[model samples]
Target: MPISHIEHYNLRAERSMLETLRDFYVTVVGLQVGYRPLSSYGYWLYAGERALLHLSEARPGDPREPHLRSTFDHVAFACTDLPACEAHLRNHGIDYRYAEVPATGQRQLFFSDPAGNGIELNFAATPDS
Candidate 1:
């Protein structure tokens, strides 16, 4: 069988930043915390069985480290519809930058979370195109 989809994402933020990040994922983004493994403080946030966000505590180190760069860029999530998604972001007081990719006909808006992790809200061009 073919692979299904992404099951979860593990994100790292400063050790002290967990609460704010949790609040953003819960209150603003509408994800519920799932079961926790005994050895970790991080919680698995559920959007669905195959869609989860895992928040992990960051280790002290140079912020300029190259390994961290890849994680800092951004993560994109598709929106059910553009208008609703835009309004939701606005209601949550999140600022975003909008762009349209002509080649794929996809529209995207980028924003950041409390800990400055980038996020993208995307929508497809048409219903049946």
Candidate 2:
């Protein structure tokens, strides 16, 4: 069978960063904190009913050190209300960059999460964006 859409992306962070990461995704990225059921310390981030991101707590001297230090170039989600999104970013004092697609008119907001994972909020082409 052909591959379908991306199910989710998982990230492991220092145990202390778990809550901060959850808040960042909820506040800055606009995802809802949802039930994980997988682990007491795990988080499942949802965009509506679709679970798009999973977070795991890192152990002491977790062997996955190298991967966690890598910056996420970005995780993108189709979005709406460019102005509102921009306002939210500013209101939260988060650093970000925005641009428009010259041909398609799709607008993009680029920023980093609290854990330094890059995030992109994409708004579809509209008469006014």
Best by lDDT: 2
Q: For candidate 1, what's the RMSD? A: 3.8
Clashes by residue pair, model 2: none
Looking at model 2, report the run of 10 residues with the lowest lDDT sum.
Answer: 63-72
* Separate clash counts for every candidate: 0, 0
- Top candidate when judged by TM-score against the true structure: 2
Q: How close is candidate 1 to the true structure, as a TM-score?
A: 0.75
Instruction: Give the C-alpha miss distance for residue 41 in model 2, angstroms.
Output: 1.9
Over the stretch 1-129, how does candidate 2's per-residue lDDT look in tens digits? Answer: 899789899978876677788888988888998878784577999999989999888877784343245535778889988889899899999888988888998989998877677788899998754
The C-alpha stretches of model 1 lying farther than 4 A from their native spots are 1-7, 59-71
The TM-score between candidate 2 and the true structure equals: 0.88
Per-model CA lDDT versus the true structure: 0.74, 0.83
lDDT of 1 by residue, 10-101 (tens): 87666557767888888867688877674756667777664478877666682422133453588778766788878888998888899999
Give each prediction's root-mean-square deviation over alpha carbons.
Answer: 3.8, 2.3
